[model samples]
Target: MLDPDLAFGEPVDDFSHCGTGECRVNTLPVLYRLNQVISESSGLADALRIILDIMRVSLRMDRGIITLYDRRSDTIFIHESFGLTDEERKRGIYAPGEGITGKVVESGQAIVVPRLSESADFLNRTGSPESERRAKAAFICVPIMLGKKVLGTIAGERVYRSRLLLKQDAEFIAAIALMIAPLAELYLIANVEKVALETENLRLRNELKERYQPANIIGNSKPMQEVYELIRKVSTSRATVLILGESGVGKELVAGAIHYSSAASEGPFVKFNCAAIPENLAESGLFGHEKGAFTGALAAHKGSFEQADGGTIFLDEVGELTLAVQAKLLRVLQERVIERVGGSRPLKVDVRIIAATNRDLAAMVERGEFREDLYYRLYVVPITVPPLRDRGSDVILLTDHFVAQSSRANHKSIKRISTPALNMLMAYHWPGNVRELENVIERAVILSDDDVIHGYNLPPSLQTSDETGTTFGVSLESKIHAVEYEMIVEALKSSNGNVGLAANELGLTRRMLGLRMERYGISYKTFRTGTPPRR
Candidate 1:
């Protein structure tokens, strides 16, 4: 948490710029206080409140809410807010498909609307004045996830005539997600760990890791074949390369694939996400830092480049870099030399770069947001990981793989899925892709007492995929299967919907999933209801 703030600096004029240097300098004071709240705030509630407050002020919005994925309800709740009456805020519960925020949560993507009245994804559950929904300006909602699991979201709504949240805002928010993400994880992990300790006999932990390990990248489909082929081709290349794909598309897996199969296979394979690092220390992290480089620089430090000097440095989200750092990276790429921050000489390094990002750097470059030269540098040999929806049978193939893996790890005898569960997985939109599937399977593995996994154990998302967006689970059918739906249904039937113990029953892939009961019955309407079948 503190780390992201460290290298990222205070993000002076971070996302939205007013005028040139002068205007940005003036706005600094106000934004500084906002940053204080966002970065330095402690405790989950305080942090969330601070975030909403900051957004409300910075964006000049009438309302802002930070809804974290509530594990207890399997739904999203407006945990904190700015510019909303208590009466309305209290009614913040969002079923998977309830409204815009709900749908965005269900779809697990950011949505921007200049006018809600004209949008098809609008959900109006809060009972706010019609003007709140119809008012001019933009409403943007984005998923807040730490790697695979989605915690909740940060939504901003400007009052009538407010400017819309642009793609840049969404991208910036996406880049800065580290702020709320870890806290959400901390909250979820705390609950998980507590329950895990209580369910001493549960073997869900190992079950999850094994299923999501390098081996779980299952697929024989043409798209998968193409992925494998690209992985193979890139594996042999010494050229710097880039991997592009959405979250849960397994960019890291592809990173692993490239490393394990490379000539430098024996060499260390190190990974780092540029966006995850703080701006101030980003350079020192990627390169090295000499003693006294900064306040806490206590001693000399070797950065990632040096640590993996003889191997590969996988820069996940490489485009999150600042232009200054991009320039440094350019030098490293061209000269294979890196100078430690605060040091004089450039150290020679023999490392290959495999950059990855879901964002479009080329377009950013065109917009003068990203460096054109750096974009060209990273585009040397690009590899694409298609989303699960486009991968055909890869979903089933991967599902089968995870089920078996989970079964063995969990010490269960389950061999396969029942037709309904299989069909549900097949028919499901898989917005969260393989990662979501893995979580669902893990849940099902524990819930399944018989040889076959049943649909009843599936998460509400998978069980009702036809109705709403499943929120954060993978839409990429190409990765893992939904283990949550079956498990939740089974747990509910057994424990009678007692969320706590039910979640404790197992752990599977979709490693980032939390089975909050946000119904996916409708995204186009707030009048919809979430009706999960009773076990």
Candidate 2:
């Protein structure tokens, strides 16, 4: 609400500008008051309402309305109004070029209706009474513009007066509109960006949910099926889970699947590597420190447990915790509470613990390296993730997944792995497990130039023969021959076993290619039949 008799700052003494010898309005005082209102207002909506009030009071305007354009709906609706009921304001909606206000917005110009009764362009959409409509009321609308872009329109009504006075009022309103144009544009841009970011955040969360689902874990081997079953059963419960696996066996993936599929899927999933933290800082890292807890502790920090409240926390390599930290961990497991490093209060936490370790905890217990009570607490539901060598043909499935993934990431067009490459992948012992297989496939994808992963594209370690136990004796000449053999085979495959075409692709004469094929025991007939020749 605006005071009807609001003072427009101190009065100016000059009154000679008006030919009638009366100073009804001063532009400088009104402009200063508007600037003060704009600067003191909290936000765009607040500022707009007060601005319209200022115009209605200072300019003696009977009614004022500010309409903003909504780009999404392609409609202009009254955003702020002065001297209009809520119901009347709700009725003032129009499209661009629909009415006088719309025309001002569409043309990016100011419009003045000298006589509302005589003008056909006046819609009277606010449902003003017939008496007011028929009275000598004038309407003025000015487009609020940022550069050439029209954001909306500011319209007001005043008693019909001389043409010069109406024109002067329109100019004053247009000047105020220009002053607030930048603010309006900034508010609109911020709102659009906020909505866009929220939409993107939702999309990424859904993608993560789909990517980490148990069914999407990328393995169908019996061992993997068992792991999946255990994950499904324990996911619905709040029991502590212990995942046992050798290094690089994807214990972290199993933990993630459990967390995202559980009831607390929307909560945070925090992962802390116990082995990555130093032994001295282990306690403060697991259970956060107070602001002045240590020499360098500058701020209070929330540890993995507190940060994972109402969620799941994955403690990888849990066997690496020292005995003292293990005891504190045991207390947390039993009491569901943790004490910060230098804080005396025990904070309650509702996090589900999923611990993973490559070491044998039972053996560590016997050797007095790990606490027995803590081991039993963690052993409640032990899930052992099998090494890659034991997963059999699942390696082929994982290999295909990694190859496609790496190809897309590296902007390559890898069609398929060659038969020899597949054979090499299957024959490897995979001591480094699934992680190693992904690295191997990524390496092969990077090295492949002909859209096919050949045996020669693999690293030297994976090129060992079953009988020879080494990769072609590590000589430069042997490596060259290996690459040459792969290239010749690939050329034959691409040329559909046409000797002359294959020879041409390999930059060799027909006779020379025939000699080299014979030396490498390569037969083109098998390639013609779409069967890879024996190496």
Candidate 3:
């Protein structure tokens, strides 16, 4: 709110124009009040409202309204005003060039009507009563502009006793509107940008939630389907899950799916890698530590278990726990309580433990390295994540996923993978599993200059994993069959999809060539149509 006293600003006693008896309307007071309104306002709406209120009192204007233009809609509507109901404000919308006010905005000029009844363009969209409209003698409307861009309009009504007074009022309103135009345009731009950012934030959050769903885990093989079933069954209960798989086989992703799909999905999911924790810090890291519990322990800290009090705690590489820590963890699993280091009292924790390990915990227990009781407790809900080599055609699915992800992250436009490159990817024994595939795809996306990933774009290790002398467990018979199939397909392609010509080129009778095609699942006519050979 603008202070009414600021507009008067201690009246000037010595009048400058002394000859005339009629006193001049002092505008210095209005200018000072406008300055205060701009400086003391919190937002654009507040500034415009206060300015309109102050101008009404100083200039004896009535029914002051401020409208803003929407470029997408090509309309101008009253945003803020002194004398309008909510319904009336809604009715004040006007298309560009529709009425007198619209004409002012479309032409980027001001309009001053000396008699309200004389102007046929007036729509009376503000729904002012007939009595008030009759009392109003003059109407002044000006375009609020930023450079060549006309942003909106400011309009008011006043009693018309003299044309000179009406002209003076119009000039004063136009000057004030010019002063506020830039800020008004800035406010609209900032508001549009803010809305866009918030919408994008919501979209990304939804994408993250969908990514953690079990269906989006990216594998369709029997092994992965079995894993999904196990996750679904176990997610309904609070059982202790034990995820077992080779390194880089997406153990954490499975755990995340379980946690997010479970009954306690709303709770926090905390994760810690036992192998990454040092021997000295394992105890405090899992069970927390009290203030002054050890050297340099100045403040009390919540550990992984405490942080996951009502949720889930995923302890990766649980095989690395020492004998002493193993005993404490075993007690926690059985009793649902953990005592902090250097504290005698035990605190109850309602956390679900989802433990993972690449090493065989059963063997470790037999060797007296891991506790036998803890192994059985965690083994109650065991889930085995399959390695990449065992997942068959799922390699192509994962490859496509990683390619799309990497293309987006690197701002590249790679859309497809060459057939030879895909064949190499499928044949390689991925010792590093899915993680390695993702890294390879990211590297290829960064290194490739074209829209497609070619065989040469792959790292040398993957390129040689299949072709290096009886490597990758591909049997000699299988390789011979593949070579035979390729040679026959190429011969058919060269002979323009003629079976007899192809048979003669391969040194075989037509009957033998047909039998080989049936054995290899090859279709001879597909060659001339430019379809890839199926085998």
Provide the overall lDDT of each model, using Cα atoms, as 2-decimal numbers. 0.68, 0.82, 0.79
- Candidate 3 stretches greater than 4 Å from native: 1-208, 465-526, 529-535
Which lDDT tens digits does candidate 1 get at residues 296-324?
Answer: 99999999999998988999988789999
Tens-digit lDDT string for candidate 3 (1-535)? 1111212122323323323332235557766766776666556776686568655766667678888777755667777787676546656777789787898889998888765776798888767776654544677889899898988888888665555556666777888788788778877787765534543443343455467888999989999999999999999999999999999999999998888788666577899999999999999999999999999999998889999999899999999999999999999999999999988889999999999999998889889999998899889899999999999999999999999999999999997886546767886888999999999999999988878786557776754534422222235665555446656776787787899999999999999999998987778778778776544
The total number of steric clashes, by the backbone 3 Å criterion, in model 1 comes to: 54
User: Which consecutive 10 residues in model 3 have the weakest lDDT in total?
Assistant: 1-10
Q: Indicate which candidate wins on lDDT.
A: 2
Which number leads on TM-score?
2
TM-score of 2: 0.62
Q: Cα lDDT for residue 113, model 1?
A: 69
Candidate 1 stretches with Cα past 4 Å from truth are 1-216, 465-535
What order do you get sorting by lDDT, best first? 2, 3, 1
Between candidates 1 and 3, name the one with more favorable lDDT: 3
Instruction: Write model 2 residue lDDT over 1-535, tens digit each, in one string.
Output: 1112322233423324355532345546756766776676446775686577667666778889898776655667777888788656756777789889888888898877766777788888768776764567777899999999998889888774455556667777888899888778877787865534543454455567767888988889999999999999999998999999999999998999999889888788999999999998989988899999989999999988999999999999999999999999999999999999999999999999999999999999999999999999999999999999899999999999999999999999999888767767887899899999899899999998889998888887877564224345346888787777778888898888999999999889999999999988999998889986666
